[model samples]
Target: MFLAAMARPRYNSAGECTFDGKIGVWPYVEWVAAQKESKNRKRGTMELKPSTSVGKEKSREYLIKYVLPAIKEKWPEEDRWNTIFIQQDNAKTHVDVDDPYVLREARRGGWDIRMIFQPPNSPDTNGLDLGWFNSIQAMFQRKMPKDLPDIVKKVEESLEEYPHQRLNRIFLSHQACMREIIKHKGSIHYALPHLKKQSLEATGDLAIRLDIDLEYVEAARVFLATP
Candidate 1:
């Protein structure tokens, strides 16, 4: 499987899109020399094999060695020092926010990167689940990759071909979902909210951030305060 990371598309002071928000995608695989000749390759040919173990150590290594560098490299130069939060689901294999190696690498180049877990059992709150994974998967399915390497290549191509506007819409939907969760007293039973994002963008009326109603905020506060 591949691990992907992204952020909301960002614009510069001139309103020009500086970042398309595709941080990077990496596969959990390593090269190994074939012990014997196979139908696909000669003996001693190096082949990509998926990692046998994917636990905290592996996750930490990926974050420290790959994800962090990608984020720093692709993030806007002006915001390099900003506190960037990497949201992930609660998985046993995921690295802790306070992982020492992660902390050490994240703070390099004066960047402040942190990790946070999405709400438990709330897949809609994840931007990947909201749309990204599906978008890339749909595109790659049409490619009909012949092998592991081809699959990785096709997946990366799909990510490159994905429309930035659609990704922005996904992030908006993610924010809207969070608002719904808050408005419903932390319940995840609400229907998905539709913003007609494409139409709005066509009319040049797309909002960068969705606003939460004050009444909903107060209601949520009251709910939390109740004995």
Candidate 2:
């Protein structure tokens, strides 16, 4: 999305926030603004944190604080029986799974929180890269954000408005893609399979977890062992 450091929300022609208006500014952790605001928010506002760059340092802050907490709260209880692996793209900005702060905080609640890096060159396996961005882009384009706060607010709203069922289907698609990649010896050159997920979901026949074929797993393991 909008990762620029500064954006001006529309104001009167004179450009003053005469109405106590909003501006689009990305402050770092409010890091320099530290200890001033609660962990939930920065020092002075009620909105969610301002939209910032998905940089390495920032990703660490968010993973430990924001994303982890949200997952803990909403994750299904049955799913908590084992370690929770939060897989993200291997972006340089994302923190390593063993970063001391990540390790320390991750263990605090007796939660086995961990990060997973996807295999490189396998964009087909990422649900976000596949279709979710299209959904987000469409939603974002529909909104006319006037300022930074409005922009952030609108983006958050769009995320909320995105269909959860669509996301579930994306996960299933990801699994399918992974299986395909394995069959191709990890090559990412195949077309993504269309599962008619929506139709299956509507008919109460869609499966949340797709079974991985043993051959694909064996194939992947064999390929990995070679190098």
Q: Which number leads on lDDT?
A: 1
> Global lDDT for candidate 1?
0.72
User: What is the overall TM-score of model 2 with all chains considered together?
Assistant: 0.67
What is candidate 1's TM-score against the reference? 0.87
**Clashes per prediction?**
0, 3
Candidate 2 Cα errors over 4 Å, as ranges: 1-54, 209-227
Can you give the TM-score per candidate against the true fold? 0.87, 0.67
Q: Which regions of candidate 1 deviate over 4 angstroms?
A: 13-15, 209-227
lDDT of 1 by residue, 1-227 (tens): 76778777765555567777777788889999999997888999998998888888888888888888887777777666557778767667887767888888878877777777777888786776767678666766766688898878877787788776777777778777878998999999999999998899988888644355532221111000000
lDDT of 2 by residue, 1-227 (tens): 33111011112344232221111122232323444677666775544444456566676665566565655665445445456555556557667757888768766777776656668777764445555457556766876667656756665555455554565555567667877887898788998799998888788786643345632221111010000
Per-model C-alpha RMSD:
6.8, 14.4
lDDT of each: 0.72, 0.51
Residue pairs with colliding backbones in model 1 are: none
lDDT of 1 at 198: 84
What count of clashes does model 1 give?
0
